[model samples]
Target: MEEMSTILSDLDEIKSALKKSVTKSDLTDIVKSIVKEMLEENKKEMETRVKEIEDVYMRKCGDLQDKIDGLGLEMESLRELNAKKDTAIRNLNATLDDAMRIANEARSRSNYNEQYSRKNNIKIFGLKESNGENVSSEVCKMLKSPAKVELKEEEILAAHRLPSKFTNAPRPVILKVKNTDIKSRVMKQRAQVKSAGIRISHDVTLLNTRLVQRLSNHENVSQVWYYNGSVFAKLVDSDARIKFDITDDVDLKIRKKLRHPST
Candidate 1:
């Protein structure tokens, strides 16, 4: 390292000394010492600027810390609110489940006699078919309740049984579904519409899609759908009995048609 005062002294002395047979080595040393001093001065100025920047950053850090603390407080508040809401929802769910169980029991009891009557008279028989083949209701019943049953289109016709095809009419399938996706959507829509105080008719394929979508928006809705322009949906079990004109309230537009009678 070049000594600061020595470099200054060398520069002062070199002018007068250079004219008096100064050695080449002495002039080289003086020039190198002056260059080192200039570099050191530049380094000091950079250090002063760095310190100023550090001070400004330290001030900014205080503001950042305040923002972080505020955000933490807001997060805590939201957590507390969420906890309360969860508790309230749990209580409501429990109450709703109890009510639905009672309603299901009542409905089951009302249908008991009809089911009992059918069970008592259900006959299993075996005989030859009209085309001179061995076929019977008992055989058909056995065929219907086959182990590892995979129903095919032909068997339904040969056995004189109704096909399990979904239709908008008063079909046996009750709910018309083409795939699992549609089934899931329907189940969800059913729960939603029922929760909104809508009565489920015998057939659901007569509902309107837009009305069902509106019911799906409710938190309590479990399913919703519209088939042939009628409204049908299911509600969360807990809220099913809560009466409301859901179809009318949701602004569903439906036109009733005259029933046709034919032989």
Candidate 2:
């Protein structure tokens, strides 16, 4: 009976140990707690790492955005500069084109036209006159015609050189009253007047009449007037005498040798 009681005790003890081993709730709870702790730590670490990564990414993105913004500003500046340059180039080309057109038009007009010197310049031309005294009337008739001249800047300076407009006008015209014989002598001299060097002293009135009639025939005579000692005649057919003034030009002097045949 003692041995059987001992064996029953041992079997009871084994059954209790087997029951404790089969119902492992406490161990499972401990393992589950440990896993939960590990999972929480891992989650925190992952969250921190994710936050750090996001910060880094944000910093890089900000820097990239700044770079992009700077590049955009630079591009905008370059575009503006290019636009200004193009505008300036276009304006310059337009100005050049306008200048060229004006130059061409002026050139075309210059071919057929001529420019004359200002007034106060004497022009020399032909005229009809009975004597040296009568050339003034012929010059007066010629002055009615239009004068053509070609003047330059240099010629204007040359006229200042001359002392007088006419060399023969140093003395005034001498007029005297005519006797009855003077009319008869003038009428007789009129027939052979052109060929012979015969000159008859006549009244101032007769001289003036003959001068007026002869000068009216010529077209080129510009002006005729009595100034100093002689009559002056101006011509308009050519650019013979109209020129610029100069300081050292010919002095006004009376020259009797330059007399032409009376017309």
78-122 per-residue lDDT for model 1 (tens digits) = 999999999999998998998887776665454443333322121
- The TM-score of candidate 2 is 0.35
In terms of lDDT, model 1 sits at 0.46
| Cα RMSD for candidates in order | 25.0, 21.9
Task: Estimate candidate 1's RMSD in Å.
Answer: 25.0
- Model 1 TM-score relative to the real fold: 0.31
lDDT of 2 at 73: 100
Error of 2 at 33 (Å): 1.7
Cα lDDT tens digits for candidate 2, 114-204: 2111112232322223444443333223332322112223222221111356655432222121232322322343334323322222222
